[model samples]
Target: MAKSNQTKSKEETGASRGRKGDRADEIVTAAFEEFTVKGYAGTRLEDVAARAKVSKGLPYLYFKTKEELFKAVVRSVLTPAFDEMRDLMLASDLPSEDFLKGPFLAFLQDLVKSRRMLIARLLISEGHKHPELTRFYYDHVVSKGIAALRAFIDRGVERGELKPTGLHDFPQLLVAPALMAVIWRSLFEAHAHLDTDEFLKTHINLVADAITTGNRGHETS
Candidate 1:
């Protein structure tokens, strides 16, 4: 004589005062803004809900808590970007130095113009205080990116296309330029100027000269 649980769930979803007009995505976007601007500890669910134009309780129905929303915001901002990086890394047949240092740097350039840099700054500024979020970002973005570079470096060394250096074993060294750009742009843009494209190219040439036995000259596109 009781309504089916599935039907009850449907009814509840429909009856939810905040569910009808609210979407998880909108909340995540708003949370991205809040988390990057006010930071994870400072952002509130009600503020996110207000920004998303939903009921004050709407974000909870989707995120359960601010920490969950913070992770979601990070994922939303980063997942697609890195998924593109994964695709680019796999499909790139350019020289290893060119591939790893070229489009990858370009991707970081684009990210600086987006909210991703803010999120990166947010993580760096607060990561020590939030180990969980720190681990999530490291595992998902940092580790994955480093692994890809390591594999690419190994392949290049084996093929004799790139000089075999200890660099392959240390992937963090590979992307340091990109991370430095992010930090410099975020924290010191006014005090100093950085030409990101030029910096990336110069960095590549320096690394290439150190790690390549080839006769290839600087190939900036």
Candidate 2:
């Protein structure tokens, strides 16, 4: 009888774990869509579970609350960008001009291509009401991004290839325009017949020109 009970316990444990895994994946997917469409306050766990085709109680099995689930979604969406940015920052031995232009453009391109653009905008729009969510993004996403950009900019200044502006604001100045462009395209330009690639290239060139110093445009091959 004891052996039969032990076997039953093991089977139940495995089934519970499988259910937990499935529920976690479902909740993450649902959270992504809900956050993108409804923003933080507008989203609820019951709604997410319904979208995921699971019981409303199922999401709580994976995520204790909506806030926790949102954080998980933010982390999931932002991790790839953070990894790419980290790699670009680490590969600093490349020419400063190429270093600045190459990764920055690639980053913008990825942002344009990603679904997270919508999620990011939603978070930004409703950030004040969900201070913890905003704070999580600040601590995880924004701080890391700013640090990487600052390191690159500081290197450019040291190499004499770029002008040294106030480092505090320099990081934002370098990236904000690109971010705004993403927002505009995602929110408005979908209906307009705009040449996105051309616009991106033009914007990148303009930004690079503004930051680059000296007569030698021959810095990078």
**Top model number, lDDT:** 1
lDDT of 1 by residue, 1-221 (tens): 25698898878888775654448878898998888779889999999989989899989987897888887876888877887887777667777766656787677667666767788888889889999988988888888888887887787777677887899789678668877888888889899999877887787778877887673343345
Q: How high is the CA lDDT of each candidate model?
A: 0.79, 0.76
RMSD of each: 5.2, 4.1
Worst 10 residues of 2 by lDDT: 212-221
Candidate 2 wrong stretches, greater than 4 Å: 1-19, 213-221
TM-score of each candidate?
A: 0.83, 0.80
